[model samples]
Every structure is written in C-alpha cells, then in structure tokens.
Target: MSPCSSVPEAAESVSRFTERPALQSSKTLRAAGVWTGAQQTRLNVRHFEFTADEPHKVGGRDQGPTPMEYLAGAVNSCITVVIDQLAARQQLTLEDLQTYTLASQDTRGLAGTADVQPYAHAYRLQIAITTPERDEHTLRQFAARAEHICPAINLLRDANTGLKVVWSFTEQPTAEAAERLSNAAVGYTEEHDAPKPFLTVTNADLAASVSA
Candidate 1:
C-alpha cells in the first residue's frame, strides 16, 4: 500500500475505483505481435507469450494454430465465458457445453472480383448445451443475453459477418421447440449486415519502438 493522506481518503479512493464504469472495448489493453519470418507471428499479451502460425502448405512450418484458428478460438472462448457468467447469475446448473464455429470465406475479391469479400466474411456458430434441470426457454434466454453482450461475437456481428447461433438441447426440448428457440437466438433475429474491421499496419521497427 502506498502512503495515504488519511484512512477516510484511502477508503474514498477505493470506493471511487470500484464504482468506476467499466471500459467498453480494448481502450488501454495492448498486445504486441512480432513476425519472426516464415509465417510465424509471436505475440505478447499482458506478459503471456504465445504464437500464431500457418500450415506448411501455406509457407509456414506448421508450428501452431493458424491465425484464422486463433480468431475462431477467441470467439468460442468469449461466448463460453459470457454464458458461464450468465448461468452463474441465473443459478443454472450446466452439465456440459460444447461449441463449434463454421467460418467460410469467399475469395472472389482476392481474385479481383468487384464488391466481393476477400477475408472471412461468413460465419455460423452452433452451440450444444446440457443442463440437468433448467428449462429450454431459460437456456435460450441465457444464450441470447450472452450473444448480446459477448464482445467477440458482437464484434463479428457488428462487422456484418453472417453469424447465427444454432442450438441442440440435451435435456428437454422437442425438435420443433428447439428449432423455434434457434430461430429466436440472437443471430437469426437480426437483419443481415456486412462486417468490417478497422486495421492498421506499421513497419516492424516502428512497432518495436512503440512497444519498447
């Protein structure tokens, strides 16, 4: 603990800190990714070091997961985290939860086709959840809440990438009910929009200096 002006002042500071509004996105969070050649990208995020690479066919040594795989994993992880929080808040017991991400890309733009998306611009995620006692409606509601708030999925949705959350319930709902729930699940309800991202590229030396 640092020197405090007074006990009450310290208490007030703590209160202010705790009551401060949360950041919406990555306001101050920063990560550094260094390209170490041969399709390997080394990353440092909050003191944790990891790597992203491509396959051997793509000119990489097949060392680790490809960057696309990392992106899918990020979305899956974020969805799970949000769902877990929602379940805990709702006092729902989850026996198991599994998620699959399907991301498709059209290379027409890469082939110089006009108005075609080059990168991954299509995605669909299917989630299968198991619960011992919760109603299907409750779980669907939780999923909707999760999608509405999950940063990663929202980022995808905001980019206009096609994403729909399909469901498979292991406890109670019939096929028809499940289908209805799936239709109401976040992605299915919204009008389709194209997703876009703001990306910036800089020289390696400049990036290094900034991180340093």
Candidate 2:
C-alpha cells in the first residue's frame, strides 16, 4: 500500500495519544537475515521476506538492493510518512509529496581503514511537496516538524552523520519541476566525493599470499 493511504488512520491514532498520554507505549521492531551465498542474504521481517545482495561486480548475484540502499530508503520512507501524517493533522491539502535520499559512505572503512568509518558519513534528503499552503514560513514550520519527529532521520543524526535536507514547496505539481527535482537528487550524490578503496592490496597479491 502507498504510504499516503495510511495517513488518515495514522493521524487519528496519533491524535488519540496526544489527547490521552496514557495511550503511548514503546514497541520493538525486529528483523532477521540469513546468509545464503556469495554476499547475498535472505531477510525476514514479521511475515515479509526479501533478499539483499551486492552487485555482480561486487561478487554477488545482483538480486536486490544492497544494505546501504535499504538504509537510505528507510530514511526516505519514514520522513514521507511523517509528512503525510502531519499534513492530515494540520488540515493541509497535499496534492503530492516525494522524497529522494542519498547516503555517502567511504568504502575504505569497510576494508578496515583505521581512520574511516564503515557507515555513511553524510546524507542528503530532497523533498518536493505540492500543497495549497503558499506561505514559506508555514511550509518551513511543517518541514521542521517532520524533521524533528522522524525516527529514521534521528537515527543517523544521533550517529553524527552530516544530514542536508532540501525542500521545495509548490501549489501545484508540474512535470518540468519533477524532472528538475529528480536531476537535483542525483546531482547531490554526483557532486560529492565518490567512494574508493583505500587498500593497496591487489587480487594478484592476495592470490600469491594464499599460494605461499
């Protein structure tokens, strides 16, 4: 189901908690993954199942999104849902909403580089929303609220990752605007430094070591 489809129900649910603080409670979410083979794994969350794998060049079957891609998607989806719920609560009409997320990590960290961290060091969240609210202040307020409350966003923020959020507000959607947003989303990643291996060890060096 589309994330927006649950907005009304989620908004009502949140309202109940606000009206009665006693309704609030913490819940734990869980997922498990089993290594299948060659950098691939099968994951289970609740009753849903999916696969995670590296690309063929990275020595996997290229079956599904890599783990980092999933992390970026999680951030995007969580913030989108929060915006939808907030709009419902605020009585704002949202004609459309979309988010694009890009995470930048140093692959050198994965290869055991001492100074580099294995996880994403920075993230960019690009949001485009079509809403009737024309006041820039009101739109900024809404964006701030969503950023403050989004769980996935906070997770990376708490870890000290540099997060840049870019928002575009429009009274109506346009194909030209969407194309620009899409290009901007990709540009953020392209403009950033690309991930590169730090280790000088080559495949031949590893093979010689193994033979010796």
How well does model 1 score by local distance difference test?
A: 0.61
Which one is best on TM-score? 2
lDDT of 2 by residue, 117-186 (tens): 7898877676777777776556656766676678887567666577767677766665544335545456
lDDT of 2: 0.67
Q: Which stretches in model 2 have alpha-carbon errors above 4 Å? A: 1-24, 175-179, 185-212
Q: Report residue 20 deviation for candidate 2 (angstroms).
A: 18
Check candidate 2 and list the clashing pairs.
Answer: none
Best by lDDT: 2
Model 1 Cα shift for residue 165 (angstroms): 1.1
Query: Which portions of model 1 miss their true places by more than 4 Å?
Result: 1-27, 108-115, 172-212
